[model samples]
Target: MQNRQQSEIVRDILTVCNGSGTTITNVMFHAYISHAQARGYLGELIDKGLIENDIFDSRQYRSTPKGLKYLAGLETMSELLAIETRRIAKSGANIC
Candidate 1:
């Protein structure tokens, strides 16, 4: 598999936890990150108010509204970038 950036990993984690929430194992598997990495990113995301652990069940983590908004914005940006790239390629313009 190809390597992913931290932001991409965060996005994957959010996507994996978007609905009813999931276990840390699920996040790790889906996000393709190690346990240590997941823990660190989860901590940062929680501090940023992007994701929250279930109060009733600590093992469960879910994406908050802010997280969803961030995911949407990121997706939009990716789409826009893809469109620009395709345009550039079609025009035979060198990006550099």
Candidate 2:
């Protein structure tokens, strides 16, 4: 897989936790990251208050309200970028 940006990885993590609380292994597998990488990013997400360590299940991670908002914003920006990219590609072809 292509190397994704930090924001992209974080977005994926948020998505992974969106439906339910998940273990580090689930996040790592779903996000396609190694254990070391998962630890680092998960820690960062928790630090950023984007994810919360579930008290009832210490091993699980859940997305915070802020994380859900971030995910929504990221999806919006990606959609906008895709639209702009398609428009530019079409215009460039016309110029040729």
Candidate 3:
């Protein structure tokens, strides 16, 4: 894959939560992001109402419905991109 986009990173973060809750450390490791990057994205996600701090577990985070919706959209886009990529590769067409 090419350089990861912020949306992709956010989607990864949301997916990692699994509705149970997850920590910044978990997201950083799973998403292959640095702590600082995780922190920044976490804050942004919280502000956007896509993620929220766990009430019972202050250190953990849970995904909101909006975050799940966004994650689903990203998955769809990724699948479409993969299909296009395979079609181009089969046809020997340049993506550039």
lDDT (tens digit, per residue) of candidate 3 on 42-66: 9999999989999988899989998
* Model 1 alpha-carbon drift over 4 Å, by segment: 83-96
Would you give me the overall lDDT of model 3?
A: 0.81
Show the colliding residue pairs in model 1: none
User: Using TM-score as the measure, what is the rank order of every candidate, best first?
Assistant: 1, 2, 3
Highest lDDT against the true fold, candidate: 1
**CA lDDT, every model vs. true structure:** 0.84, 0.82, 0.81
Choose 2 or 3, whichever is better by lDDT: 2
The clash numbers for all candidates, in the given order, read: 0, 0, 0
Estimate the TM-score of every prediction. 0.82, 0.82, 0.79
| 9-92: candidate 1 lDDT, tens digit per residue | 888889998999999999999888899999999999999999999999999999999999999997777666653333245578
What CA RMSD would candidate 3 show?
5.7
Worst 10 residues of 3 by lDDT: 81-90
